[model samples]
Target: MITKVTYLIATILSVKAFPQNIQLLSQLPSDPIEQPDSWAWGRHPKEGFGYKARNSLTLEQCIDNPETAGTVHCDGYDYSYPVELCISMPRLAPLKVCADAKFPKDFCVSNAANMVKAKGCQKFLTDMCIMDISLATSQPCADAEFPKDFCVANAVKLIKANGCQSYLTDLCTADVSLAVSSDCAGVKFPASACTSNANFAILDNCKGVEFPASFCTTSVQIALLDNCKDAKLPKEFCVNGDLRMIKAKGCSKFLGDICSQSLELANSADCLPAQKSVSVFRCTRSRDICLSQLCELKVRDKGSCPQ
Candidate 1:
């Protein structure tokens, strides 16, 4: 049942994905972004004119590196570029074309031509960056009495039966899991079911489900530590002790670092941590992500940041 697709390699540049060379794309003009939703990235920037553009730039990345990730572009849409990969960059090349042509249509579409050949490949990469940690992917997102088999699949089925576009966002975005058993807090599956999970093989069949903050509780915190353990613990955890070291995993600086790469080790955790100890695992992973971003940037934007 595994279908393989053809892919094209886009050879060029690095992976540090910079948003754009243009002032608008890179930095907002005013604080609060002056009704950010009104901007291109806004979900409802204008009445009957906005379509969730939060990670529009990321979408551009997907189009640029369809070869690396695997995907195809659909002709015609707001997206001027081809919809190639999940990690897409914003459209710059097509924007110019549309601007010069002075067409009413947005060029984000045709602009992103899929270099890769995999179906749904674009979404897979997007999930990695935007919605990477999902509870539906694993067993017992929280300690519960739910039967072992009562997994994301069942939840998907129930949700679809009820009729809904979103069914799993509640499972993975929480500061903690809410259900005591296999019951999925009434989340219904969308028409896009299997569209995400089937596409992403990395997490098996639990893609496209993003729980808010309810799933990030102490148990979830510990779970985050476990994930960090697998990825390569921060230097703080390695030195202070491993994730299970109670304190290391006890919502301490070490734990925070694992949950958020943005979070650095506290001053108390280590002085001159950079010189004292840098996480080999983190450094390597970050570099890899950085590389992916760079390559995506080069091909998608034509030597310039995606517009």
Candidate 2:
């Protein structure tokens, strides 16, 4: 059973800047395959799509070849993951960075941006979609430390430069993969030019199986779970804390989800209902917070306060 814990909505609303035409997406046509289900198994329908079936090498093949990479299986299997999965974590670039008549043409921004506009012009919405993609592509991006837009932005650059192509069958795939395999994306340097500051290529999430259940490090997860009190947190989050609940940050905007934005809709509950809330960036997993806002104001329940 799902628990609905009450939360004290924040009194303040933090206004964010959304673009004037960000809502122009209703004018764009969506790709049907990009719908929810097909995207999960990482299906890529484009031509040069899909991985090779023989990506995994057996011990015998490796022993005979003496040049085999490893015994593990790779997505190089006969199907390509969705483009979204390839660059799973998404981050928004300025409308300027990805703004081209040719964007996502050959562009994913066309699809992602549409999803962005439909969310009523909010970063949180954009972030959530990207996060979901990141999870599909790699689990770590779901953590607070790994924002989704970041992945989207980076992946866009890689795809655009590659001219839409890849899979193990092609000796040369997309630019990002090409760069990694050939070590020429400038993501790294030649032996003479290599430095610690080089932009490191990271494996996507599920690929990072032993990655300590957080992005880049363990501390980030600990701090977030500590703060939010773990409303709907997954277990991968840490569980070390006082277990005391605190007023959730940005509760007003997020509060509506706990019940109804309309007082009448929420009050429809015959009795006091417990509202469950999960903070956006909590790291550690802990007990759910139980909250009640309408009453603590100390107003008399009898007469009713301002609607």
lDDT of each: 0.29, 0.28
Candidate 2 on 164-205: residue-level lDDT in tens? 122121212123354355423323222221111112213121
Model 1, 72-181: lDDT tens digits are 22121234333332224323322321222221112222322321112322222222211212422322122212222232335443222222123344332221232222
How far residue 189's Cα lies from its native spot in candidate 2, in Å, is 3.7
Candidate number of the best TM-score: 1
How much does each candidate deviate from the true structure in C-alpha RMSD? 35.9, 36.0
In model 1, what is the error at residue 163, expressed in angstroms? Answer: 2.9
Superposition TM-score, candidate 2 onto the true structure = 0.14
Stretches off by above 4 angstroms in model 1 are 1-161, 165-181, 185-226, 241-243, 246-307
